[model samples]
Target: MPSTPDTPSFHALIPCAGTGSRAGTAQAKQYQMLLGQAMVMHTLQALARVPQLSSGWVIVSPGDSFEWPTVNWPDHFRREACGGATRAASVFNGLGVMLQAGVPAHDWVLVHDAARCLITPEAVSQLIEACRDDAVGGLLAVPLPDTLKVQTSTTQSAPSPSGPRVDATVPREDKWLAQTPQMFRLGALHAALAHASATAFAGITDESSAIERLGQSPRLVPGSAHNLKVTYPADLAFAELVLKGRT
Candidate 1:
């Protein structure tokens, strides 16, 4: 379907441009097998269950040669090769394409990570419901459940031989681990990220961070711990276990 304007719509913007060097995979981790399909396929399948989403766009880096799974793929969701060097850049560029394609500025965009294949439709729906009427959008997050730690400061000449011991225990109160499907207005998120583009998107780790720089606070809807991003090799095993359990 073609992009429509005026009426507010929910769109999923997934940035799938990163190299999975840390994952020890020969290809991008998103394309790596998970359960019976590609890692990102699981992510997209979950998004397809959300009835409120108008469309989903997967952003891949230019010249990405990975063959995407086409069988049973949602017609409303498609891939675009407008990815940038960093996650923030990919998101910003994706937003630009959406706007140019006639997506309304007031429309809601849920930015999710392709590696976070465990995200459920329920969690995404919760975020949409929580932020749909609010002035600023929100993201699904979980309160810090584990004790926080700060690494000991080390000098350039001398490093800790004990593999960087913890210097202090940080207060976990009021601290939350940010998670994906960060819902925000298209114009708001685009402008926030555009502000940081000059600095190569430095300090902009997530969509919420970019929005925070605009002096606006995003709401935090409680998220499930099961919604984890697959980064390391061990994480894939855990994700597969979880996916199998869900089945």
Candidate 2:
């Protein structure tokens, strides 16, 4: 895993197939305007700033009707309509497309969320620097500081009409909230995802989880809280504020 002429290069892959239903936007959340540009544009622009990233790819669903913005995209940035029904499926398909396009098996692929528009080039570089030479690659994450609660229904085997009750208080000291630009070897990640798909494991929510299936632990590089995923309507406004402050 040492970097050499024979070692594979790193590339960025953004999964853009999600509909962002929670955001309740008229258009897809990634396509929604944020500070005069598409939300995903901000994400791509940040990745474009990472010099170590040789190229970037966006995975879109087949027959996607959303039009690309007229703004000039970077030469290294490209889009493919090979997205699948689920995020894991989309990443797996994109990995296959990259392989067919001549990317090597050992090449590093940083799978990022398109909705994480607040991610910076520095954060992307941080992940790469930490994981580039490691046996198992890693991802950007933040230590969970909130007091977590395990809620349960008051009634047995059924949810209470009123609401769930706090059944337990979980320790937050050891918890770290996972974030992305989850870097892993293309071959390993593809294989892990393929295995999950074959077994119908719907819990493979992130690249790290997929990698964990192979009994390999990916490193966790500390990332800023600003690198939040835009999942709700209020998140858009928060992202805009963070972007404006950066400018």
Candidate 3:
């Protein structure tokens, strides 16, 4: 793993280039308003509010605008345009930008989604501070409150009329749902992702998988349900309520 950069401060990498087809909106979901501003705007605000988060860089799509072009960014935030097909690809491109800008390897690189509008500065601070100990890196996660399920191998239990197992719910013993703003040392995370991409294992979903791929387990820092991503349109309403609480 690479060593941490001399710069101890955290920098945010918000990937706002997704089409958000699941959101069922004409405009990209990140460009849509949750309370009043664009979804990405809220996420950027939450990160920027963290005193330790010295700066922010948003990765936007090639043709698409970073946003409506009317609303201005926070004092120190900047924009970049290299977005990728997968979230990992987009992040890889942004990492390069940060490196070219001479960001340190030790600096905290937080990868947050644009749709998670309920995120708060407090949550961001928790994530940043947790990354301090080099032995452990952290990701915001919520313990499982709902029951989980593990169906049989086949969709149908009857296996073509032969005796078969039942569609049973799995025991929710210690499961946790992972959230974003996942922070890690620039060098460590970069090496992990690079190794994963080098092999045929490009299907990894989250940053945790990249760590696990390198034979290390990432620590989970508790996060609230309010940090849920805005996948469906209804999620915007939930995020609106979450935002109201923090305000």
Candidate 4:
């Protein structure tokens, strides 16, 4: 279906406040160089291609000291320095800023990961096309292909280090590994995240989780495995290779 005049505008929100300790980088992972540019620059470049997006916002730490790139940014792109300590907090805070700026509650918001530098414009467009008119919104995800194992271990064994034993094998038939640009309505997401914060829900890993708390199941659009999140040092090289392949 085509978007009508009443259809809410789509906006992009990227949370980039984390330290990325596991990445083993001296600086924040988003600012780390990838393909001769800051990693987050690639993410923003992909977002800029989505003409349907009304605007793009990056949530950064209040005291962030990293220097922004000198390249010309998209005219619709903006940055907010009200990021919080946790990912959920950062997103929620950014949402507040959007509301203050008069962005309608019913407007669609695509929350993407800054570290997912391999995310392509095609993948982002796929997500928007699938969720633009969806009642509950959705996200980009890839199904797991590897055999799953459930480990059993207890922390009480202080005498010696013991290896975890596989307790069971989980069925991967209906399982999907979640990825981003998670799309949802601004009001609904804000309410969900607020509820999570009030209830002290520490497991609010992603925006979808907060939505799930409201009993809404978001659709999972198929995404490529190449859209991997750059979590570790080795993953940076893999992302670089993917970028090179595109050229």
TM-score, prediction 1: 0.95
Write model 1 residue lDDT over 1-247, tens digit each, in one string.
4435445789999999999788889989999997779999999999999999989999999989988878958789988899999899999999999989888898999999999999999889988989888888999999999999988777633676768887789999999999999999999999999998988999999999998988999999999999988989999999999999999
Backbone clashes under 3 angstroms, per model: 0, 0, 3, 0
C-alpha positional error of residue 113 in candidate 2 after TM-score superposition, expressed in Å:
0.2
Ten residues in a row with the worst lDDT in model 4? 153-162
**Model 2: per-residue lDDT, tens digit, 89-181?**
899999999989988888899999999999999999989989988999999999997999999845555776777778889999979999999
Q: Rate the local accuracy (lDDT) of all candidates.
A: 0.91, 0.91, 0.79, 0.90
User: In model 2, where do residues sit more than 4 Å from their true spots?
Assistant: 1-6, 154-158
Writing each residue's lDDT as its tens digit, candidate 4 over 41-81 gives 98898898887888999999999998886575778999999
Q: What are the runs in model 4 whose C-alpha is more than 4 Å off?
A: 1-5, 155-162
Error of 2 at 58 (Å): 0.5
What C-alpha RMSD separates each model from the true structure? Answer: 1.9, 2.1, 4.0, 2.3
Write the candidate numbers in order of decreasing TM-score: 1, 2, 4, 3
Better of 2 and 4 by lDDT: 2
Native-to-model Cα distance after best TM-score fit, residue 4 in candidate 4, in Å: 9.0
